[model samples]
Target: MPDWNRRSVLATGAALSTTGILAAVGSTVAEEDASTEGVATGDPPGWSSVHGNAANSRYLPLDDGFPEPNTIAWRSDTLYGVSNDGDIAVVDGRIYIVGEFESTDYEQTELRVASTDDGTLEWKTEVTGRQRPTVADGTVYVSGVDRVTAFDTEDGSLQWVREFDSEQWISNATAADGEIYVVTGGTRFNADATLYALDGEDGSIQWKRKQVEARQENRETADPAPVGFKSAPVAVANGSVYAITGGGEFKGSGSKPGLQWNGGVTALDAKTGEKQWGVVLEDGAFIKIIATDAFVCVQNMPDGLEETVLDSETGETVLTSNSTRAATADVRVTHDTFRPSSGPITVSTYGTDDSWTASDIYYFPPLIAGDTLIATRTSESSIVGFDLESGTEKWNWEFDGTPHALAGVDENTLYFKLYKADRPTELIALRASDDRGEGREGDDRDETEPDDDTEDGSDESDSDC
Candidate 1:
């Protein structure tokens, strides 16, 4: 049985929009006038998307100066209260983003938008859910509590909205050509993992592929099973969308042994939700793909876990390695019944702890800029970058606070936002270059310091709870 919320989809999106924290600089609103120019101000200076580009390259070109050591550019304060892990997009110069924050009044989540220029307000349409916004066809696409929506980028006007029967926890949206794709799932026991394609212009349903249940069983609780798509699907030039899903409850038993439920990649026809190919991965394997002329850099597990790269066309194994990183999931048991499991379960072969241990990470999707693949890794404490082509660790930049949001801008810069860290949540810039001359600063760009004349907009002044 599927858990469908009875609330109106519009109401849910409106609800999620108001909740969730989307911090930019984490600083309070200063007295000075903040710029709302965002990317419109000029060249995008930091991580533009979570994986950086549609290619999901956490990698950036190091020829010039990008992510160089410790260099902060313009650090603008973000919307006060909301929290955001939503990937960013740069269009028409403005940096459009949706973040969630705890509302002090009702202790609910709030979504807001800030400028990339000086971090000024650009009209934030409040909606619910943690799904990131996918900007395409001149419209902004996002998932709320129970639906996908498209908003006019020019005036933040509502273009069209489509509702779903289930709730979407932290999903991601992808778009190519004229179609918008969305994946929905959450921490609840519902594992209806399915993919949806909506018209890019009017938000009509192009197609919906009901995900098949995995042949695995629950290792812990026998009460209910977890299902649904947790990862965002990547759109390819081959006219298909790629993504992963957890197979839930084979034979009506939630848990399974061996590779039955670990996970796998499913390719769907873009025009019509047709299944192209599906591959079941090893017991603990996860897959990520990077497109290239030679081959798509299908990074297997980024952690010490092993991974096999398959040919994009035929889904044939091309490369295999156990040295990559894959995102870690917290499928542990908690005191509350609402928690995922009834006991401590291993989400990955890697040890199940919060540390940066090889097992506690998910290598961010690699960024493909020019001939380079920029890759990044994240945890509650640090954010690091690596070169996709050589698998060389270009740089490892640590964050004082845990970052819920991260994205790559170009070959030379990576952008990220930190919360509960030392300073106000910040949107810091790193120079990606190799010409660090010893004592010389790795990044020549001046750090983004608050202007003296601006108002004292501190993080404390943030919205509500």
Candidate 2:
């Protein structure tokens, strides 16, 4: 039997319906005096969205006079493990992450904020979902299983929440031009999905992209395929939102029963959810999206080993490579040609030396921090930093828990999401330093003083647990 019918259509589809519980759930507070002007003060340069900024170029350009790589800044005093529960966002000197902490007696999803200066807990509040928190214009937006919640960056107070129907769930979200762009998936594989453009301030449904609607119009006498997205959107960039479609199919009482799912990329206007262009991708088990200004990369696997690159504005094939990158249900990333991946990294020194290749990496992209490339080990809870120029390992950190590169705040500091078996999840920040004793200072950036500022930054602070 079909998982749903026209009735299931209530939850899915891009109707301009106010189908959500629109309300700001908490006390409305005034802006903090932290900003010199009315603008949120301390909202200096830092990572604010999934891949950091609209271009999604995971790269953070550093200042010339900053410290070296791998210095431990501070880890959240709360030792919760943050693995895949959520991603991070940094703005106004505050780092934000979402995680669901569950125990025998307690279970809750929290949006956590800490001071970037000291890793001091600023405030944490119960929230709805555990996707990457998108911080912009002093508000933090989070996507959960079925709803999108917005909280104030100042105190974690609720600003607004938009609850979608029970059958639909948020896959990924990013903010651009004061609007929130979201891609949602259906509970069942064939249940069809939707793309939504929502107002950032009050959670209003500005418009919803009607893929199914368009399909229905075209097939007036036939059964229209519901728009499905196992994972839809890349990030909002260049005034456009990019997404990959699982390509809908009908299995019962339809013209195309058991229709094979087609893989493809769709680009929509960021302001208006209208289709700008789309290109079909090869049928693959998993499809991931990596977008740069010049091209959109569709990877066949999470490691980006088999991939296709399409022109960003026009759906023209520009290039192709073997690959994939991380996608929860298979999809995610940035601009710039230098995307770090799980494949062996062969760095060229261009000198009287042979190039070095780092191997056995997990099938995820490494976090790029200027000249230092941070890669996670495949089998253990370890992260290694390599000098791009010398093509050599500069430092590394082995943690008791696994860590995912979360953000590069500046040239000097980077943040990570750490996860252990049964622990809830936590975020950690590290400062890059050039000075060390004798050997490599490749140690986990943990237990360092909040105010540590020295040549070595006193590696004694590294508990290495």
Off by over 4 Å in 1: 1-49, 59-71, 79-86, 102-111, 168-170, 185-191, 211-237, 246-260, 284-304, 323-368, 371-406, 410-413, 418-421, 430-465
Scanning candidate 2 in windows of ten residues, the lowest lDDT window is 1-10
Name the candidate that leads on TM-score: 2
lDDT of each: 0.42, 0.53
Best by lDDT: 2
For candidate 1, which ten residues in a row score worst on lDDT? 9-18
Candidate 2, residue 156: lDDT: 62
Candidate 1 per-residue lDDT over residues 114-195, each given as its tens digit = 4444345555655554455566656766666566666666656566656666544435566666666666554313335556
lDDT of 1 at 339: 15
